[model samples]
Target: MADVTPNVSLVATPEAVSFLQNCQLPVQLNAMTGNPAHYDYDAEINTAITNLQGKAKESATLVARLTQDEVRTSPLKHQEASKLAGRLVELAEGTQRLLTSKAKGYMDASSDFMGKTFTPNPQREGYYLRAADWISREAKNGEGNGYKAIREAVTEDPDFAVAIYNTSHRLLGLPKEHAMDFAEKAVKAFAPAALDYIEKSQRLDELAKRYPAFIAQVRSSYFSPFELAKVRTYVEMPS
Candidate 1:
């Protein structure tokens, strides 16, 4: 199990509060229908917004933890570190899409004023519930490998790598040219462990100290091997 920071908080921003307010149902819809199975659209949308905000904030904190010295330097933590980080990234990005996208804005507006109840897209609610459960379970267990969805994404999903790289660069607060050059240096320095050639348990910390971009990448990606491979140039294990 990787290092755990159990007090992670999923804070909802004021903007999120206002945005969710715009999505509230009018008084007429508050009454429960005679049917026992009647679904509450207002409750559903509010819950989705609330859950997404909390999860995204928690993911940011966990991603920050994944970049800590202990986790980054410990060979034992590397694989689990990547799995947790990748899943958080997937979760964060999905939350961002559902919360901030223009399509969501349009949809919410229609739903709020135009009498629409359920979203045509079931995947939003589906992923939210599934991911919320998975995260809750993993938070308690500290066994990071249980989330197979992100593991598969980090390995086979190019988009995952792309998103991590792009987001990481910005998160690092680096200029584009400097960020690129630094990533190249990180690729050379961390390639062995990333390729599973040498554990280089201490070496990861040494290199991270030298290359701050490496820390940013790990903070953003937990040093996902696929993201490492996708960093401008591909790196492979030497046979």
Candidate 2:
């Protein structure tokens, strides 16, 4: 009889191990199993990754151009940047809808727990609706007028968290470092209300994870690189 050979397990390379750690477990496992039919799957994955990177770069370029244009414009010239920011807001709204649709598509595509667990749910719809309504009201007043409306709203109702948050976001376009102070004030004003919504949504299983990170990101997004540079200039100038 021919001598039987012992089976030796293959070890993952350092690079492969690092990649696996970064990826979701199912994807990592699929790559490791190395079924012949899936052997070249990395090519498709790499292509997708490259495409995503290119898209992100393009978006970043657009945002930078918009910011530069805003900086160069006078207060009287705010119309141009206002229009661009409005367009961006519209794009963000559309992207959110698209994401929801895609999630539904994924739920429909899968079977068993994969499908069941990802089924459509309406837990945070109310919170989103409230936020959207607030944003819409502010948008109706026009871009340059956001700060005024926010101030009026806050004056009428000092406890209005959403209005305070909107004020912070509006100030992001301003050249003065005072915008940072406003942003901090907004965070303080909105934290309680925002946390209440977060807790309620979490209790309802709407926000499954990363709730704190989500809130933090929203708060921080008020200041971009261009805005920070402007703020710094304002700070350095003598009164």
lDDT of 1 by residue, 210-235 (tens): 32332233244343354344343435
Clash pairs, candidate 1, are none
Q: Which ten residues in a row have the lowest lDDT in candidate 1?
A: 28-37
| lDDT score, candidate 1 | 0.35
**What local distance difference test score does each model get?**
0.35, 0.35
Give the candidate number with the greatest TM-score: 1
Best by lDDT: 1
lDDT of 2 by residue, 147-180 (tens): 5664454334333333333334443344234344
